[model samples]
Structure formats: structure tokens, C-alpha cells
Target: MNTSIVGTGVAVPPNVVTNQDLVKIMDTTDEWIRSRTGVRSRRFVDAGTGTSELAAEAALAALADAKLDALSVDAVVCATMTPDRQTPGIAGALAHLVGLSNAVVFDVRQQCAGFLFALDIADMLIATERAATVLVVGAEVHAGYLPWGDAWEIVLGQSTREPSAEERAVATRYRAWSVLFGDGAGAMVLQRGAVHDTAASSGILGSVLHTDGAHANLIEVPGLGSLQRPYADAAQISAGLQHPTMNGSALYRMAVECMPEAVRQVVAKVGLGLADLDLVVAHQANDRILEGVRKRLDVDDAIVPSNIGNWGNTTAATLPILYHELCQTGRVEAGSLVAFTCFGAGAHWGALLYREP
Candidate 1:
């Protein structure tokens, strides 16, 4: 049997922080951010909000798009690195919020490879007859973990001509993370498609997922997890232990290498080649990384589409959000062969090939 992503939805916080706005609080320039990451602006959440809010909204929207009632959903799987809390998980909380009262609910943290993980799990559930419908979501509230800065005020449309008391309290730190991440959520509904579906039909074709824990340290929040409670005091915060760290050069190299290979593995598994694909939705890590993958695959611009310029990197939300936007454009019509790939903090990477219906 084939699994189909019947509906898709995305929601991003309203506040927009432009590169020009970052210049006031950081040492970077608009040209520098754009040339490096291909991101001109990104959205950040308001002070009191969290990822669950975004996830819930996106989930409901996806259900509506699928023309599915919440009660009909048999499972809710959320993928996120930035869950609102330690217990109950985002998927559990979201199930209640979205009225999937009897559904199996859980969350997975595969970093940027999260949506791919969720898709794989949902597909298996459908294929095994364990579930009739599954709702998968990828959401992030990375902005909350970023060091407080005047950029927050600027993004929120408040006066930051002078740094506010709250902004001044944080001190200048993790400038790169602060400027690169945005808050958003994206979701999709999956169901069993016709058993005889093919690339010429509308359903999933093949998928590949990989992980290398030895390289996990390349991109991580050195301070956030249970082993390290770095948010306890001012000294810890000053040590840069409260936010994520990255070996940029290493990550970029791996992403460029892994993403394309995963794409190829999935394409070949389904009896197709790069040339046969209609669209390639890659992780919104960086514009340069995606470009490297595109060149390595020898595909043209039209096949690989991107939204990193406006949304920055919403982590796990990137792939589904990109797919949702692409669907809206009518560029990926029924029966079109579409592929997606992503690499993130876990040293995790994955790819999926699907046919639209």
C-alpha cells in the first residue's frame, strides 16, 4: 500500500525581523547575513508564547485542509527539538488541543530530520493497518532560546532605538543563533493511498533516514538538556552555555554531502533518478548548503525551490512548510514526483520521494 500526504498547513509568528534590524543590535550587516545564509528576514514569537500554540494552529489547519475531522485522526506525531516542556510532549498536548482525544500521541526529536521521521512512522502505521489517518507536525520556538537582544524589540515593532532594560540585561551573546532562527510550525495529514500507486500515481514512493552520533556535537545546545542545567545562574549564561553551538564549516560540509546522498538513495529505491524528479524541497538550513546539494545533483533551479530567504531556518518545520507553500503555487500538481531532504543537529539526515495526488 502507498501512503499519501493528503493535506498540508503552516503557521509562523507574525513579527518580522529583517537583516537591517539585526544591524542595530549585532555586528553583522544585511549583506553579510544574506550572502552567508540567503536569509533576509525571519519571524520570532511574542514574549509569552511557546511552540505548542504554533503547533496546535498548524495541526488544526491541516485537518481542515484534509477535510478531515479531528475525531477521525488515529494518531498524532509531533517532531520538535523545542518542546514547550519536558513532560507530556508537544504531540500529547496538541492532541488534546486539536480534539484528537483517542489518538496515540507522542513526539520525536530528530532535529531537522524530524518531519521525515514523522512521515516514516506515519507511513508504517498506515501500511500495517494500525492507523487509518495520521497527523504529523514539525514545530519550533527557537527564538525563545536565543539570547535576549534589542532585535526582539525591533522584530516585535517596539522602539529599540536604544536597547530596552530587558535587552540590556542579556548582554551580547550567541549573535549567530539569535539572528538565524525563527519561530513557526508546519503539519500534514497522511492516509493510505491506492495500493497500486506509482511515481505516475499519487502517493509516497520511498524514503531514507540516517544518523551519525559521532558528529552530533557539530551542532547542539550544549546547555539545555538534563545532563547540563546551564540556565541556573548568570555565570553559566555568560559562559555561552544557555544556547546552541555549532561548528559551521563541519555542518555545512556534512549537510551538502548527506542530503544529496539521501535523495539519491530514495530516488533509486523507487526506480527513478534525479532527472525524473519534478521538485526537490531541501531543509532550510542555509541557502548556500542547498545550492551545494543542487549543484552536486546537477539539477536546475526550477526543480529545487526554496523559502529560506524569508523564513530563515525554522528547523524541522522547514521541509513541511516548503512543501505546503509549493503545493499552494500549483507547481507540484497531482502525479508530480516530489522529493525532500534535510540535515540537522543530531547529525541526522533524511529524504523522501512522493507523488502528488
Candidate 2:
């Protein structure tokens, strides 16, 4: 059986925080941010809302696009680093919100690589006859965890000596990330079908996924996981260890190296090459990373399209959101050779290849 994406959708919070707006709160300038990350604005959810809400919205929209009811969905797989409560999982919460009472639900966490990971899971379920249709969603509420501006402001206010080299590095990295992230959700409806029907031109071809935990600390929330429990301690919270941190230069190097290699692997798996792909959808991490990968593959700029300028990296939601936007613009058409890839925290990286539906 083949797994085919029948529909796609995306939902972003209405609150658009532009670079000009960020300048008021963070030590940054609009020109500097745009020059570095190619981001102009990002969306932020209001208080009291979380990933599940956004996932539900995107899921419902996807269902509507597929002309299927929520009750008809056989399963749901939500990919996210930010779950609503972390116990029941974002997939369960989203299923409940969308009234998919009977569907099997689960969550996958691979940070920016999450959406591709979730898609692979859903594809397996249908390929094995465990499901006829599945709803795969990638949603995140990153704004809540990204308080870099506030953290930096506090440090600047309380510092007595000029910050040490280490403190300066931390501040600089977080400042860059704070301007690079946004909150949003995206989803797709996948259906099982004949694997080799000549009439069918659109379906998932293959995928390649890789992880290197040895460099996991390149991007992480240090004090929240089981290894560093008691995350609620005032000391941890005050020190800002509860929020995400990263070694920006290291991560950038890793992303450019791994992402294109994964893409090459998946394309080769399907007996194609970089020149064969019609559109390359990369995770909206940064302009530099995307450009690096594109240059490494020796492709033209138009081959890889990005919306990082309008919506900062939405982590798990980036790829699906970009897919939906492309579809809306009539860019994706039947027989188009599309490729997807992302590199993220956990040092996870992945690539997927498919034909447009």
C-alpha cells in the first residue's frame, strides 16, 4: 500500500510580532534580524492556550480539506516538543478537541524534525493495514517557553561586572533564537492506497531519518527532562535553565551538513537525484542553513522555497505550514516531485520524498 497525502492545513496565532515590535523588548534591530535569519515577524499564542488547541484547529481544517469528518479518521499522530500537559500527549488532547473519540492517538518529539517523524509513523500504520486513514499534525506553542528577552533584561539590570565570556555567549545565542522562533500548527490527512497504480501520480516515495545524540546538547531545555528533574525549583526557573538553550554555531554547522545528506539519501532511495526534485521544502530554521544546503546540492534558489521571513521557524509545524501555503498558491501540482527535510534538537535530522497529489 502507498501512503498519500489527501489534504493539508495550517493555523497560526493571530498575534503577529514583527521585528520592529521585538526591538522594543529585545536588544535587536529589525535590519539585523532580517539580515541574519530572514525573519520579519512571527505569531504568538495568547496566554492559556497551548499546542493542543493549535493542533486541533489544524487537524479540523485538514479533515475539512480532505472532505472527511473527524469521526472517520482512524488514527492521529501529533509531533511536537511542546505538549499541552505532557502526560496524555498532544495527540490525545487534539483527538479529544476534534471529537476523534475512537482514533488511536500518540505523540512524537523530534523538535523541528518532528513533522516528518510523525508522517513516517502514520505511513507505517496505513501501510500495515492498521489504519485506512490517519491525521498527522505538527503543532507548537514556542512563545511560552521562549522568554529570552525577559531573561536578558533581568541579567542586564542585575549585572555588576561586565558579563564574562560565557555569559555573553549565552545572551547572544538566546537573543538570536528568540528572534527566530514563532508558534503555529500544520496538519495533513493521509490515506492508504495501491502502491503501484500507474494512474496514481502522487504518494509518499521514501524517507531517510538520522539522529546523533552525542551532540544533543547543541539545542535543549537543560532542566526539564527526567535526567534533570524537579524542574519547578525556583532556582532553576530563575536561572532560566528551564528554557531552551543552544550552541548556535555548532548547530548551524551540523544542520547544513546533515540535512542535505539526508535529502540525497532519500532521493537516491527512490532512484532520483537532486536535479530531479521540483520543489524542496526545508524546515524554516534560518536563511543561512537553507542556503547552505541548497548550495551544497548545487540547486537554484527557486528550488527551495522558504517563508521564514514571514513566519519564524515554527519548529514541528514548519514543513506542513509551508506545504499548505504552496498548495494555496497553486505551486504544488500532480506529478511534481517534492522533497522535505529538517534538522532539529536531539540532533535529529530527516528527509522525505513524494509526488504532489
Candidate 3:
């Protein structure tokens, strides 16, 4: 049994936060941000909005593209670090929104590597005949969880409210991770059989997934869980553990070093190489990191499509969003070779190789 992507869609918030606009409230300039992260802007959900809202929008579009009713979807796999709440999973909310009453809904919390992991699981489910169609979604709302302050205020701006005293303490202690993250969502539909059967092009050929829990603490939202002692203390609040924390330099090195190898393994497993690939749709975490992997692999720029400058780091939503854009523009044609790769928190990394049918 083989599973292939039949439809794709992405939903970014209507609100766009540009670097120039950010400078009004933060101490940083547009040039500084662009030079450091290649991010000219990013999107954010409106107040009271959450990950499920974005996921539902993207999922519906994908279902429409597949020419299938939402009720036809057999399963809903939501990949995200930010769920609407800490319980029930975003999948259930999305399933309800999309009207998939019979679908088995669940969530995958692999952070940036989430979409890929969800895809892998969906593939297996389809192959095992558990589902004929699976909808996968990745959504995040980092602004809701980001810390704000004089030192870190420039990176986050004043878009969100100030953290409580406890949240502030967490941010202060974890000041090193106060900046450098953004959010959004992306989605795709994977179905059983050939692409033509599903009214799409190709199917997934092979995939690889790896993780190192030893590095889990290197990047994460630390305080919301029960593990923290003196939980919710003002000091913890100031450190930004209530939100996402990233060890920038360390993360950069890990992604650059881990992703290329993962890509190599996947391509080699499929008896292909960089030269054989038509496009590389990777996790849109950082531009410099993408360039590093490209240089290491010696792949041409044209073979890679990046929307990070416009969308920022969407975590699990990155790959599917890029895939949607490429398909819309006809960059990914039938029979084309496309490679997907990702690396993020949990020191997780993986790759999937596909041939458009």
C-alpha cells in the first residue's frame, strides 16, 4: 500500500507584522532583524484565536482541493507545539470544525518536526488499511506565549500583553531564549492508492525519523508542566519558560549539522541524491540554516523554495505550506522528485522522499 499527498492548503493570519512596524515599539531596526534572521515579517492570530482555528481553515481548503467531503476524511492528525489548550488535543477541535464526525482525531507534539512525524504516522495508517484518507495539520500561536520586556521587547514587540510576575521571572532567568521564534499553520491531505486515484500527482516513497531526548531541555516551554519546582514563581515567569525558549547559537549548529545528514540518509535510502531531486521543501526555521544545508549539499538555489521571510518560523506548518505554494505555482509537477526535511526541539530530525505520481 502506498500513500500520497492528494491536496494541500495553508492558512496564515490576516495580520502581518512587518519589521518596520515592529521598530516603532521595539529598540531594534528592520535592518538588524533582516540581517540576523532573514525575516521581514510574520503572521499572528487575532485575540481569542487559537491553533485549531488555523488548522480547520487549512484542512477545509485541502479537503476541497481533494474534491472530497470533510466527512470522508477517516482521520485527523494535528501536529503542533501550541494546541488550543493543554488537553483534548487540537485534532478533536479541528475534526468538529471540519465536520468529520467519524474521524479518529489526535495530536502529535513533535514541535517543528511535527508535520513530518504526523505524515509518517498517516502513511502507516493508510498502508495498514486503517484509513483511506488522513488530514494532517500544523498550527501555532507563538505570540500568545512569548515574553515581553525592555531587553527582549525589541524581538517580540508590544503586540501581546505583558507576562504576569511569575511569567516575567521565567523570562528573566531564561533571557538567553527570550527572542527568536514565530508562529503559523499549514496542512495537507494524504490518501491511500496512487495520486491519480486521489486526483493528485505522486505518493510518499520512503521516510526517516530520529530524535535525541538528551537535548530536549535545550529548547522548549519549561514552566507550564508539573516538573518545575516552585512552579509559577515570579523568577520563572521572568525567564520566559511560560513561552518558547530557544538557544539560538546551539539550535543553529544542531539544525545545520543534523538536517543535512538526515537528508543524505533519506536520499540515499531511495537511491537518489541532491542532483536527482527537483525540489527541497524543508522546515522554514531560519534562512542562514537553510543556506548552510544547501551549501553543504551543493544543491542549487532554484531547487529550494523558502517563504520564511514572509511567514517566519511556523514550526510543523513550514513544509506543508511550502508544498502548497509550489503545487499552486506548478513547480511540483507530476512525477517530480521532492524531498522534505526538518529538525527542531527534542533534537528531532527526519526526512521524506517522494515522487509525484
Model 2 spans > 4 angstroms off: 148-173, 194-201
Overall lDDT per candidate, in order of appearance: 0.84, 0.85, 0.80
Give candidate 2's total backbone clashes.
0
- Candidate 3 at 84: error in angstroms? 1.0
Give the alpha carbon lDDT tens digit for every residue of 1-357 in model 2. 468888898999987878866565446789999988899888888767989999999999999999998889999988999888757678777888999987999899899999999998888898788999999999999877766443433322333344445644555556867788999999999997545556554688899989889988898888855765574678787788777877889999999989899999999998888888999999999998989988988898888998999889999999999999999998888778988999999989989998865
If ranked by TM-score, best first, what sequence of candidates would result? 1, 2, 3
Model 1 gets an lDDT of: 0.84
Report the lDDT tens digits of candidate 3 across residue range 1-357: 368888888888877777775554445667777777778888777667988999999998898898889888899889998888877678888888889997999999898999989999999899899999999898887767754445233333544554455545544554333234566777888887663355343578788999999999778777867787766677777564577656788899989888888888988887777788898888888888889888877899877677889988888889898899999999998779988999989978899988877
Task: List TM-score per model, in order.
Answer: 0.93, 0.91, 0.89
Give the poorly placed runs of model 3, Cα more than 4 Å off: 149-180, 195-202, 229-235
Whose lDDT is higher: candidate 2's or candidate 3's?
2
- The prediction achieving the highest TM-score against the true structure is 1
In candidate 1, which residue pairs clash?
none
Over the stretch 145-234, how does candidate 1's per-residue lDDT look in tens digits?
A: 877554466545586576655554453445655667788999999999855564444687778999899998998877645776543667
